[model samples]
Target: MITVTIYTHQDDITLDQLKADLDSLQSTVEHQVVTIDIDTDETLRKEMHGSTPLIKVGPYTLRPPFNRQDLEVTLRSAQDRVKYYQDDAEYIKRVERGRRVSGADRFSYWFSKQYMLVLNALVLLFVGLPFLAPVMMKQGLTGPARVIYAVYSPLCHQLSFRSWFLFGEQAYYPRELAGIEGVISYEELTQAETIDLNAARRFVGNEMVGYKVAFCQRDIAIYGGIFLFGVIFALTGRKIPGLKWYLWVLFGLVPIGIDGSSQLPSLAKSFFPSWMIIRESTPLLRSVTGLLFGITTAWFMYPMIEETMLETRKILGQKMEVLKQTQKANR
Candidate 1:
C-alpha cells in the first residue's frame, strides 16, 4: 500500500481540508495517512514552516494551495509508479532503508552530542591517575601505586630527576647539570651516574624523598595543560575560536622543541670537544614548554573537532527526526 505523509503545524487550518480530500479518494487508491506535527521540533519547524500542510504521496510532494484535483492526480501517479516498481530491487532497498533506524545510529546521534563531555572526562581521568600514584604511595598503598606507575611507565620517561615528588622536602629533583640551585640535586642525593638513563629511570624515591609521580614533570604538565584548557573550553560553552596554524607552530611547537633539543646537547656532551658548552633545561622550563605545547595543541585541534562534530550532529539529528516520524507513523 502507498503511504501518504502530511507535515503540518498546529496553526495550519488547511489540514482538515487536505485530509478530507484524501478521504474522498479512499475508494480510488489504497493508501495510509501519517500526520506529523512540525511545530514540535525547531528543525522541523524551520524546514516545513514555509510549506505547512505539506503532503507527500509516495515520492511526489504537494505544497500549499494544492486542491482535490492535485491530490488525486498525485496519488494516482504515485499508485501507478509503485505498482510498476514494487518488485524492483533498488526501489525496494530504498524503501526499506528509509524505514529502518538501527541501534548504532541512535548511539552515533547521542555520541555526536555528548562527545566533548566524554573527552573532558577521559582527559581528567587520564591526567588525574598519575597524581593518584604518588598519593597512593604516600598512604602506603604501594601495590596499587606500583601498578599505576607500571602502566604509565611505557608512556613517559618517569625518570626520578625529571619527575615531581609528593610529600617530599622538594617538589622536584633536577640533575646537577640543570643549574637549579637551593635544593639537593639528583647527583648529590642518589650518587648515581648523571648520564645513566636507566638508573635515573629506576630510582623511585624513598622515605627521605617522597614517592615520584607516575608521570614525569614535563609529561604531567603537558596532560595537565590539556585538562586545564578542556575545562576552560567547556566552561566557555565551546565557542572559542581555533588557534591559527602558524600561531600553534610558533608558540606551541617552537618553545618545546628548543627546550627539548637544547637538553640533547647535554646528553651528547662526551662526543663534543672539551670547549663546547652543553645545556640542560630545568623542571620549570620543561613544565612551561610542555604546558604551552599542550594548551596550544588543544586550542588548535579541539575547535576543529567541534566543527566536525557539529556537522555530524546536524546530519544525525535530521536522520533521528526522520526516524522519529517513521516510528510515530508505524504506531
Candidate 2:
C-alpha cells in the first residue's frame, strides 16, 4: 500500500485544499495518510516551509499548489513499481533483507526504551570498581589488583593521602597540607626516602598504612554520587524533569568550579611575585565539590537523555511495526 504523509502547520491556509485533494484520491489510490503538525516542531516547519501541506504518495512527494491530478499520477507510478517488484526474482532476497533490518530496528527501539537499565548497570560497574580493587589487594590477589590500579591511574590521581583504604584503621589519611588535626597525616606514617609527591600518586599502601583503593577520595565521591543518583532515578521510575541549565550551572558547575579553580591560583602563586597570595584546599573540600558535581551532573543530564531516548523509540517503533505488517502481508 502507498503511504501518504501530510505536513501542515496550524496557520497553513492551503491545508484544507490539500486534505480535499487527498480525500478525492482515495478511490484512485490504496494509501494510508498520516498528518504531522509542524507547529510544535520548528525543525519540521523549517524543513517544509516552501512546501507546506507537503504530500507523500508512496515514494513521491508533492509540494503545495498541487491538485489531485498530481497525486493520481504519483500513485499510479508507485503501484506500477510495486507490481514490477512483486514478480521479480530479487523480491524474495529483498524481503529477507528487509526482515533482518526490521528485527534490528525493533531491537534498537527496545534498547532505547530501556536505556536507563544499561545506564544503571554502567554506573554500578563504575562505582563498584574502587571497592573491588581494595578487596582484591587485601585478599592477596596482586595480579588483578595491580591491573585495576594501572587501568584507573590515568583517570585519577589515586594519591594514597587523599584515598580511602578498605581494610584499614582509618578510612582516609589526608596530606599534611590538608590541615586536619585529628586524623593521621601521610607524612607521619611514611618517612621513607624512597617516597615523593609524584610517587604518592602511585602508592597503593602496604599492611602498615593499609591498602588504598584505585581511586582517590574525590573520585570515589564523584562516582558514588552518580551511582546513587542512578539508583534514585530507577526507584523513581525516571519521572524527574530535566534539570534546568541555570540550575545545572548554579549547582553542578559552580561549587566544583570554585573548589577546583581556587586551588589552582594558590599553586601558581610561586610563578608570580612575592605580593601574590594564594590558598590551598583540603581533602574534605575536594570530596564535597566532587560529590556535588557528580550528583548534579547526573540529575541535569539523565532526564534530558530520557527525552532523546523516547523520541528514538517513537521513530524506530513505528518503522518496526510497519515492517512487521509488511512481512505478514507478504507471507
Candidate 3:
C-alpha cells in the first residue's frame, strides 16, 4: 500500500483542492491518505512551507503545485522504479549508491560540526569593518571610506561629535555644546555656522582633524565588546550556559537603554521645560555604558546559540558517521 500525506496549517488556501486530488488516487493505487498539521510541529513547518502536501508513492515523493497528470505520471514512474530495483541486483546497488549523500552534503555536515569557526568569522567581520573605514580614509581613499560609512550609517548615528577619530589631535570631536572641559570642542576645530548635524555626521575628518571611524564611540565599544566576548567563549569550547533572563535585562539591556533613550528627547532641548535639564552624554560615559551592554548581551545570546549549534553538530556528525560506515560496508 502507498501513503500520500497532506501537510498544512489551519489556513492553507489550497488544502481542500489538494486533499480531493489525493483522495481520487486512493482507489487506483491502494493508498491511504494522512494529513499532518505542521502548526503542531514547528520543526516540520519551517522545513516544509509551500512545499507540503507530500505524496509518497513507492520510492518517490511528490511536492506541491503538482496536478492530477503529474501525480499519475509520478506514481507510474515510482512503481516502475521499485519493480526495476527489485528485479535487478545491479540496479539495486546502483540505486543505493545514488541515494548516498553527495560531497556537498558531507561539506554541510562538516560545517555544522565546526559552527563556532563560522560564528567567530562573522563577529570578526562585523567589528573589523568600522575600524577599516578610518584606515581607508587615512590613506586618502575617500571612495572606500564613503562605502564603509554608508554601510554603517544605518547601524549607527555616525555623528562626528560622538565617533572615534584615528590619526587626529584627539580621539573624538564633541559638540561644543556638550561641555566636556579643556578638550577641543566641535566648535573649536573646523567649527560650525549653525549646528549642521547631517554634515557633522558626514565629516570623516581631513588630515588636520583625523579620520573618523564609521561608528560612534558607544557603538564601537558595543561591537568591540561583543567581538571580545565571542573570542573568549570560543576559546572556552562554548561550554558556558546562557545568562539568566533577568540578569540579561539588568546588565545587558538597562544601562545602555537608560543612557541612549534619555538622550533622545534631549535632541529637542526647546521641547523640554526650562526647569528640566537635558544632559548630553560625554564620550567616556558613552563608551563605558556601551561596553557593559555589549558584553552582557553577547554573554546572554552566544551561549544559547552555541547550545543549539552543538546539538546540530551532534546530529550532523552522527549522520556523517553512519554514511561513512554504510559506504565502507557497501565497498
Model 1 RMSD, rounded to 1 decimal: 4.6
Q: Residue-wise lDDT of candidate 1 within 1-331, one digit each (tens)?
A: 6778788888888888888889999999967787778776555677777888898776799998789999899989998998899899999998787667678877877886778788889988998898998899888999999999889989998888889998988898888888887999988888766568887777778878988888988887888888888888878877899999999999999999998887776777877787766887888899999999999999998999888876676656655665676677678
Model 2 residue 87 CA deviation in Å: 16
TM-score of each: 0.76, 0.71, 0.67
Candidate 3 per-residue lDDT over residues 146-220, each given as its tens digit? 999999999988888888889988888776667888788887776565556788788888888789988899987
Predicted candidate 2 versus true structure: per-residue lDDT over 46-114, tens digit per residue:
567767877765568778677778878877898788788887878757655544555567677778767
Winner on TM-score between 1 and 2 is 1
Per-model RMSD to reference: 4.6, 6.7, 13.1
Off by more than 4 A, model 1: 1-94, 272-277, 329-331
- The C-alpha lDDT values of all candidates are 0.83, 0.75, 0.74
